[model samples]
Target: MKATKITAIDFFDDLSSPYARKRFFVGFIVFGGLCIVAMYLDHQFVPNGAIKAVLDSVLANLLSSILVILGFYILYTFFIGPNDGLKEVVPTRARDISEAMKQLPEKTRSYLFWGRSGSYFRSSPLIVLDGYARRSKIMTNVDVLMPDPFDERLINSYRDIKDSLGEESDGNPLLANVLATTICCAVLNANNRYLSVRVFYSAFLPAFRVDLSDNGSILTQDDKSKGALFFKPSSEFHELLRTSILNEMAVSREINLEEATFKKKKLDSGSCTPEILARFGVAEAARSALAPKIATLIEERRHRYT
Candidate 1:
């Protein structure tokens, strides 16, 4: 079957809804409150002599504490809070582009993974984003890390290109979404590949770095006499890889097959229906004849941003 095509309209359609806007405001308020409370507690409990002296000179400690808390509440609520809002608001356009890019085809996605090698486990965020972008038909550009002169110029040029394509002065929102999606895609693909390889090889592989050539190339060493070295995959091995991919896709998309399976099994159960089984693939079934584990590998990374 052909893959689904996602469009820019699909990406941005639900974002501007009243419900979404309310949720965004609620999130900002909660974050700002937490920041204010933490700042107040730190300033109050830290016991600074200078602060004590100032309090003694101006007012009592009780009043001082109250004043500090009120001051910080206002400061954070007004200045810092709105800055955070801008960060969210400005990134909406970029985010839409990133989402649109996710619908790209797999062959195009694989190009992002090509220039890197080293036990396959150390594949970076950029590579994964490229792969997903190619696979999903998403347009993505890597933020290259290099020394000062090259780094600044390259990144600036990249932003300029993105802005030109996007028809916006600042590509901040789109860039933010691209970076976020890149990280998400990288983590998801690497985890899937790592689990698949580990199951296939029955061994753990250490992550390692790979150096890429200036022209974005990597050399693969081949031992010709060892015919079918990489080409030889048993039917069982192919099944395993396919199953792993399906399960990874399900988990990434937050689809709970087990619940669906359970409801279906109650209705009619010789084994899982072909459609359900096909959606998850065999590895999921093999993991448990009854239920598949539902959890987010990507959600764990939310702490990094929050």
Candidate 2:
């Protein structure tokens, strides 16, 4: 025979139930003991009959008020405790990226896009690729600045993640996909819908949520993120990104992902010229480093012959 564990919940249910006569009688006995103690203290504290009578009345009122308040609290807790969860909200201060993803609207016009950097390097654009492919969203015509397929920083980052999290990320589908392909990955909810947009910058992703709506809000992972001011996408920034991507698509030769290869002869500094990227507010150092990487990827594409 298996031994049954007696839980506080089971004990509490018996004691609190109306039909528990023995328990209720014992509770009254305890209450009587408490009353005796209170009365003894009161008599000792106020020996004068006239003053003691007045003090006793005041104390009785105070006790009655406290008891009433406590009774109300107990009643409310018993009646509303279970179902009150539905009405409770996760305040913005308490919200994290994971929680924000959970509340995302299934079909939305925009993604809450953000990705951290390698201190100064541009974050990966694989997040965009993953979102576009997984969502199969024709309506969401958003612009994304992508890294070269074989960008040194990007490739290195991918290798680092794969080596570090190959087996560890197995259970987490999102993490697994991200590890599988360093370039692009998306996470799906229990319903298999796309979760909010954000990219992995380092090996570990922090829990933070930002809603990139017309009027957006941010919930960061920690005090550091909290202190950092979130950026609002400007029209100029949006247009610049769109133009950059379109320009890249226009100039690049068609090649499938698997078939793509770097062309040493075609690789030129002009492919990711700083002059072009500078106009779009890309930092001088970032643009200089990023240009070559971007150009190399573009030049390397194996153009299909008609």
Best by lDDT: 2
Predicted candidate 1 versus true structure: per-residue lDDT over 225-251, tens digit per residue: 111101012223333433443343333
Per-residue lDDT of 79 in model 1? 63
Q: Model 1: which ten-residue window has the lowest total lDDT?
A: 197-206
Off by over 4 Å in 1: 1-150, 171-178, 193-306
Instruction: Tell me the alpha-carbon RMSD of every candidate.
Output: 21.9, 19.9
Total clashing pairs in model 1: 15
Provide TM-scores for the models.
Answer: 0.18, 0.26
> lDDT of each prediction vs. the true structure?
0.31, 0.36
Candidate 2 has a TM-score of 0.26
Q: Give lDDT: candidate 1, residue 249.
A: 32
Candidate 2 regions exceeding 4 Å error are 1-95, 102-107, 116-138, 142-149, 154-211, 215-306
